[model samples]
Target chain A: MYQTNQYEGMIAETVSMRGHNGDVINAYVARPLGAGPFPGMVVIHHAPGWDEWYRECARRFAHHGYVSISPNLYFRDGHGTPEDVGAKVRAAGGAPDARVLGDLDGANAWLRSLPYVSRKVGIFGTCSGGRQAFLAGCRLKGLDAVIECWGGRVVQSKEELTPNQPVAPIDYTKDLSCPIIGIFGNEDKSPTPEQVNAHEAELKKHGKQYEFHRYEGAGHGFFYYDRPAYRQEQAVDGWKKVLAFTEKTLR
Target chain B: MCTMIAHQVRIQGRGKSGPEWFEVHEANVSYDHPYDLPLEHALNIDFVNETLGPGARVAVELSVDAARQLVKTIEAVLAQADQRGVLEDRPVAAEPARSPSVA
Candidate 1:
């Protein structure tokens, strides 16, 4: 396994890349500064926006010996505060699935193109991003691991379909090509416990390799430390599980 | 939960951006996670001008109860103003040329 000491150097910055349909978008990239190969991750930002938390997530991945990049999914809306961009995207009916998939494809490709990175790549996201990560694993090629953190609407009904989200991600479980891990809050109403069960059942029917960890006292976005629903115990445990899963699969 | 449900409508108003004011062309309202509020979820309202980018926005996140109270207060104020002839400017006669020019 790759190891790094506290004294090791790291680089984090905002970079640009071609996204879906050749649109240029900004992304936050962070990785160790050494000249060795390291596992990489695509840190998908939550629906709240590509804000400080997402930047911290990229840095955290680098601290754990992984190159990480988080593409600004709302960049097409033009530059501004995360909340403002998020509101604009929400007003436009949220980011389209095709665009997100294309952006993730670009991010994954960019990580692999780095000289110090290995071929192994994993993807993870929070809230709606979780769903995007899972979708990336299903649609994209060359991913080693997939992690979904309380992504809602993965198993949506027909009524839930909109111009933005036309189909459910769960519908693509049969095509999932990588080892996957899902962390969910049992109390989250968006993807209720029942939806998680249905998703698990679908995965099982497809005979896909997957594991799910649900927290008892947590609800949606339990990992958001600054929010009221944060459960420290659950978030810590979930983090440990996610690291272990990625290490085993991506490394 | 990232409740992706949001309602947007065209509006005409003005909002402060930096030291100046700009025309606000739209408003979006939703019940979802607030960016700055401590609450897990609240009724978020954003007044903005898309052409000015996301920075040209005025946002508010209000608790459910507080939002309801605000609606009630607005209705009460409007009713009182109508009774006091505060809304005497008839819309049919208020043409573009008849209104005071805005610089």
Candidate 2:
């Protein structure tokens, strides 16, 4: 069984952890102030880098009674604003898939080591982060739930394959250990409706426990309020679904 | 969508790094989500020198039409330069500036 917490306020701060072969990296952590244990979540930042919106997402998870940490995936590229580092990483052909997996493992370990954590941790991310969450959920163990928000390239075409991304996340569907929740927009072209359908089909074939919610009149990054793609109706519904899914699965 | 499509080119040029201009080694062009632009996607070009680190980059994100216009303008200017013998007058291998004041 899991423990309970009764904190009145939340504490959010920057912390450090070992990542990708014991290299120290910076991460933002947020959690409610409490005496009891709380479910943990690794909030993976999108390809935009660890920006303000990603920080808010971690805070939102903390507000919902989950201890959350958003790791700076591009820390190796050097730091000086999220956009700058993001561009550098992009220019350098992005971090390797193996490196990402190692960082996620480090995050998982960090969460489990926390004193107030229930050890029933989940992983969540938006955009590329969402894709990483799916990848980590399938490849890594110890996650109770996984939330993928508008992740693309899960079911990639031959033309879409790159040297860095040799395999599609859907190929790992058979090894998925926990329940997964996916939120997508019909207008998203990367993971088009057809691709989403293909991913769903693969999950079904593998008998994996998964739930997907597709929003109408929404496109990629509909949850980003600072961008033109923000869709309030769909974002609200998606948030509710995420909260409920984690509440049920992380217990 | 995280479009990982980028066309990279080896270039010898200059880019402003804060108050000073530095030699740039490469340019990356792609149509992807802009960091500050309001548009969902735009033509983003980054002038970078990896040796100078991540901060040594000058980036611009333009709309589709704007990007097309830029392409035409560049081509027209280069063609005009060639016609006027300006291209032939330029040095074949321009040397890097020894100091920031050279710009």
Q: Identify the leading candidate in terms of TM-score.
A: 2
Query: RMSD of each candidate?
Result: 3.9, 3.4
Positional deviation of residue A67's Cα in model 2 after best superposition, in angstroms? 0.9
True contacts kept of each: 0.75, 0.55
lDDT of 2 by residue, A71-142 (tens): 899888786768878887775555667888889899999999989999699999888888899999999989
The lDDT values for all models are 0.86, 0.85
DockQ of each: 0.50, 0.50
Best by lDDT: 1
How far out, in Å, is residue A119 in model 1?
A: 1.7
* Model 1 chain B: ten consecutive residues of lowest lDDT: B94-103
Q: How well is each residue in B22-85 modelled by candidate 2, as lDDT tens digits?
A: 8878898877778878886789999887766667788998999999999999999999999988
* Stretches of candidate 1 exceeding 4 Å from the true structure: A1-7, B17-19, B88-103
What is the iRMSD of the candidate numbered 1? 3.3
